[model samples]
Target: MSEKEQPRLASGLAQKVVDTIAPTIDRHVNIMNAHGIIIASSDAARIGTLHEGSVEAIRRNQIIRVAQADDTAGTQPGVNLPLILNERLCGAVGVTGAPHEVEPLADLIALTVQLLFTQEREHSRSARRAAEARDIISALLAGHVAADVIERTLDAHGLRAPLQLELWLPRSEQDPLLEQPALDGARTCWVGLFGAHWRLRKASDEPAADAPNANDRYLIGPAAEDAGELLAQAEAMRTLAGRPAMLPRRELEGIWNQDIAVAVARTPARSLKYLAARAQVLNQEQARTLLVVAAASSMSEAAESLHIHRNTLVQRLERIGQVTGADIRQAAESLRLQHAVYARIALDELQVF
Candidate 1:
């Protein structure tokens, strides 16, 4: 950790400790930082002031006792005990009474301060590790880092892979279930909030034993060497979520490659933005009719699916061609129109508007 980022016993916590300790011990108590500046004290005037006896206690890593007769600048008649956390001097605690009388109370308060500091440091370290883990996952999925680099980075964070990635989108932003850990039995798992969704990656030999509940949508990507492919599968899953024909319990694995319609849907919005814009010329009914025609086996089947006469379907198709400047009768033109429909769906799912 950087020097500036190193955790310290916060002043508020120090004050609370002083308040707790003061009731039991008749002596006034003060908490001082490493620099000997008083952070919290039972005597309010002492706060923000330097305590010379506490400075000496920290510098010597031992107790310093001052007498009233030997008063010096910033010195008080009390016992100062250095607060040590993990073998390092973090601060000091001072008790305002005769040296022999308050020495034990000062020692007890110092121990409490050390314990609190250790706990705070551990919590800080855990938070920093979680943030680093999320950054690595995001970079890998975005294809900004190569596999070799990711391997090294993960190792540096003490994370190993053979990892599984799961994408989840909760129905509500404040869902409490999102607080649950991703995989209970994995060696180590990292869950992060990515905009409107959550991304979970775990290092495990096999899949998670349990799945998330129905209140949230999830797509579990297969274990693979390339994370970019998993990202593409997530994109395809999002596109499918917006489709009317998508089943509630559909398996999303391999949908990007095994299904031609989904494969076309996976096309990046930037690549099909022009066609999506041109598609805007048609109304919602015309667009729906076009998608039905492209999906159905025959013109009559398409009309029946849309609950319209074949002639009406024919006229709508002709009008769609005129608006988008594409002949829906030709095979290639029909495929392009289908791709445009998927692109629109993908863009909408992405919230590109």
Candidate 2:
């Protein structure tokens, strides 16, 4: 078989298998890869050594029995069985003993190794598919692919169109929600890790209630064509969720019309820069004072929370207003300042600034 198509023998697993089978047969067992290089053996010194009989067995895909008289350098009197997985030559198993006595043990070891190879191959394939799914979803969300191309790509990947898309903003990359079993439920369902969230797209027939519980804030976009509308809605929900008042909710549930309003209200480029510049100019104490004043009910409460006299709090607020061009005492301007803060946070999350 070609090298790329050869089933690999996991050395560590092969070693464990050899160790487990060696004692039962009372014979030294060696596992050799398709190249005839010993990877695992009860006799540690034999590892990395080439076995001529094992190499022949792999080449011929048949058992080879080496007699003591026929043994050459690095060759032992043993029964060497070719390891085959899915009709592909993977490796060989050798048991050192009389041919009649060790042939059965060699066969058993070969079967065990074949089974292990199959399991590892499946695990590797699944991981590869998951990564491909992530890449495709990220590209779609980023608007890198045309609608027709996306549909074709989805079909190629065994997913149908008119898919329901959900954006999961987990607390962290390692959040337990990412491990939920529901993520793997349907072959048609695709779950992928996006920049700061997990994106899930499911068939229309599949109910959204069946999705895994992320146990954190998530936005469910309406099912739409080209996934373009869903992407926009997801961004809008993210901006709204960035606001302080909405930060505590565990889930956004579904897209709302008001999300468009929030998205449209995003601070303009000039205003974003102005807010950022103002923040950059503030000292740590001034920044904290501004935050406290914006969140507090009154100047007295703000002073108490900051552990400062009311007069001192008033002076800090006035100084902050003079520098940032926003009067904290007025409700409308205070709300504007808070919105600017939220805008900065949203932009940071979106990696826009």
Candidate 3:
């Protein structure tokens, strides 16, 4: 690993390594710091003393074997190997036994130590990046972070621009997506919790956006181009929850129109409630008639779609007006009346105005 990313081989970590491998082998194990002093040993009495074989192995950056006749003070006849990670020498490990018998065990122990160190480094890096991503997302939503600042931060973290964000509400607490690992440089997307909802941000070109499936667990918001747009979409989705009539149908998508109808999506809840209340008094037949009339080019065309006689459709419209307190025939009131109908279909009656 690079110097900045290298993990320290503290006494605790050294002791852990000795404890793990010593049990699997009959030989005594010793983990030494880069300075050649034993930091951890299966034989605790040898701690803090220099191992001659370990010093030689570290100096040469290779395995060194001390024979029975050649063994010196503060050392035993054993095999020692240098611990190298990402081309950098970190420390050494020594196994006490005949040189030939302990060489293989020493090699295995060295590899294990390097793997543990590598894992620790990666875990640290992932945590640091996650914190950075949360901060960037929070600042962007708050409007405190500039576009240039976002661009620079993303570049530094290996994330690209021209990103699209999706908002999703989990249908249950056991969602599998919640278990996904944190974002890293290798990933093109990141999932995070923002406020009371979850936001998934990914590269715009990663995949095509599809209409939400009726059986899906999440109620997804439209892909937003920026944090401001995302906020508005989130608001609309939350307000429309538990009222399926306001959402898009599987065969005919209507909710997607919010992309162009930004004003409707951003409508204040009080105004929406008032508009919705106008249609709340209508029965199912009257509500359906009003929706058809609002979408139809002419009253006759609406009658044709509903499979009802033209005169019958007119009578239904009159009844709808009487109950809704708004006339659908007036051009000026039609738009507001239609919005009111949509608001009515999308919001729950139990919700306070």
Q: Which prediction has the highest lDDT against the true structure? A: 1
RMSD of 3: 5.9
- Candidate 3, residues 1-353, lDDT tens digits: the string is 35665546878777888898899897899998887999999989989988777788889988888887443365578888898875678689899888889989988988888788778777766667567766655555555556666666756766553345444444444666544454544332234444223344554444434423444323445445554554444455544433433444433332234432344445676777765666678766675676667667788998987899999998988887787667678866666665665676555442111
lDDT of predicted model 3: 0.64
Q: Give the Å shift of residue 92 in candidate 2.
A: 1.6
lDDT of 1 by residue, 27-145 (tens): 88999998999999998988999988888898998998887835446456889898875666778999987889889898899888777777776677666655675676666555556
Best by TM-score: 3
lDDT of each: 0.65, 0.64, 0.64
**For residues 1-353, could you state the per-residue lDDT of candidate 2 as single tens digits?**
23457566789989989888898878989999989999999999989999888889989999999878453475667898988877778789888888998898888888888787778776776676677667656655665566677667666665564555555555566766564432332332236443445454655554565454545655555665655654565455455544423332232222112432264346564565565553444555775566566556777987987799999988887887888787777877765555554445444522111
Which runs of model 2 end up more than 4 angstroms from their true locations? 1-6, 10-26, 35-52, 55-75, 99-108, 141-156, 170-177, 180-196, 214-216, 227-234, 237-353
**In model 1, which regions exceed 4 Å deviation?**
1-26, 35-39, 42-50, 65-69, 72-75, 99-108, 115-119, 126-130, 140-156, 170-177, 180-196, 207-211, 214-216, 226-353
Q: How accurate is candidate 2 locally (lDDT)?
A: 0.64
Tell me the deviation in Å of residue 78 in model 3. Answer: 1.1
C-alpha positional error of residue 51 in candidate 1 after TM-score superposition, expressed in Å? 2.9
Which ranking of candidates, highest lDDT first?
A: 1, 2, 3
Whole-structure CA lDDT of model 1: 0.65
